[model samples]
Target chain A: MTLEEVRHLLDAEVLSGHEYMKKEVSKAFSCDLMSDALTSVEDRTLLLTGLVNPHTVRTAEMLDISGVVFVRGKVPDEDTIKLAKENGIVIMITKYTLYVSSGILYSNGLEGASILHN
Target chain B: MITIKLKYQVEKDDFMKAGQASSNLKKVLKQLGINSKIVRKIAIATYEAEMNIIIHSEGGSIDASIDPEKVKIIVRDRGPGIKDIELAMKAGYSTASQKVRELGFGAGMGLPNIKRCCDEFAIRSSFGEYTELSITIYHSGNNTEEGGE
Candidate 1:
């Protein structure tokens, strides 16, 4: 599904990259550990994590993620949002827990992110 | 035989700009036609090492050399050096200050992560003298540098 559909399904707030929401995303990864993430997700998949720090954006930058979905209603500060904007990454925030978010995306046709290659 | 050198003046113990050097090194490696996997490996390894310098030491600079077969990375800092290299290499062993822990890193995975990525790794730290890290990544021959920063 496209990022727009994911955003709509989760009632997410767009913090940046409004123009790129229509981009297609095949899978999603939910993790707070950036190191695990670096070696884990292989491609430009959607990142569903609650890290809420600039390193989240930086980690996505290194992995070339399609977008970031912050779980548990966490919102990025101005610096974090600015960093996301600078990297041209789509950002979404949801009130759902990580498990719930993963299940929702999984049931909605978003696959696990490991299959995508970096 | 293309080589690029980008210099960044890192401040002493400033965590905000810690990733700048590694990100730039990644950019340059991409432009140098390095493959994405190798580039990512080099980026992660060098970035973590550089962050250690910024978070634990007074600060340091990174020097990268690109060739057709390999990428060599060197990070050096003139600060309070590591007191125990053996202990430091153990995962979850950290000498990071309270400020470093607040950033979600410095959980003692820095050197181990670096070791996991590079083909060749060397570290030397003198007590109250300095710390320096050298890492090299050999091209796995995929040949496409396409990826994000």
Candidate 2:
């Protein structure tokens, strides 16, 4: 699915990389743990996380994650937003919890980042 | 036949800047035109090592040597070294405090994840002295499966 579709589905507000809204994402990994995200996902997957911090951005950067969806109505601090912008990562905020956000996307045919990679 | 070296000093408990070293390394590698897959592996390994120093050690440094064939990262930290290296290498064994967990880390997967990303991995530690990790990722001709995800 395209990031634009995800934005509409979750009612998410883009906080960074607005120009990349049409970016395509085939898989997503939802977790608060940076370690878990690092361990599991591959490059270009979307990260749905409630953990709002610079580390989240850094993790995305390391994994080449295409974008981050900040779930649970959480907003990242200035540093977090700055880092995401610097890396050209799309950052969005959603009012839904991580569970609901994952459900919405999954129900819409977005696959989870495969556990076989771990 | 040139090697680029980058060094970073990491402060203990400095959660604010824990991943800075790895981030900078990633940028340098990209600017140097390293393969994105190899750069990603190196960055992840180095970042995990950096976080281990900040979250567990007194302080440390990470040094990267990048060349045409491979990148090697050396992480050295002065801290209460691991008494059980084998146990520490386990997938879910972590000694991080609750505070660290609340921040979305200390899940005990750091070392294992680092190993997973490296073409060459070695770790050494003395219980009271320090711990050192040597991680190397080849630039090409690697056995790591690509496009598997």
Best by TM-score: 2
- The docking category that best describes candidate 1 is acceptable
> What value does DockQ give for candidate 1?
0.31
- Encode model 2's per-residue lDDT on A1-118: one tens digit a residue: 9999999999999999998898889989999998888886465699999999898999898898878999999999999999889889999999999999999999999999874243
Instruction: Put down candidate 1 lDDT per residue, B1-149, tens digits, no spaces.
Output: 55555666666777667677878887777766777777777888877877777777787778777777788888888899989999988877888776666566766777887887788999999999899888988984757755543
DockQ of all models, two decimals each: 0.31, 0.61
**Comparing only chain A of model 2 with the true chain A, what is the TM-score?**
0.95
Candidate 2 wrongly placed segments (more than 4 Å)? A115-118, B141-149
- Candidate 2: the clashing residue pairs are none
| CAPRI tier for the interface of model 2 | medium
lDDT of 2 at A14: 96
Q: Tell how far residue B133 is off in model 2, in angstroms.
A: 0.4
Q: What is the C-alpha local distance difference test score of each model?
A: 0.79, 0.88
Cα lDDT tens digits, model 2, B1-149, are 38988899999999898788898998888777666777788888898999999999999999889877889889999999999999999988999999888788998899998988888999999999999999988885542445532
Tell me candidate 1's TM-score on chain B.
0.90
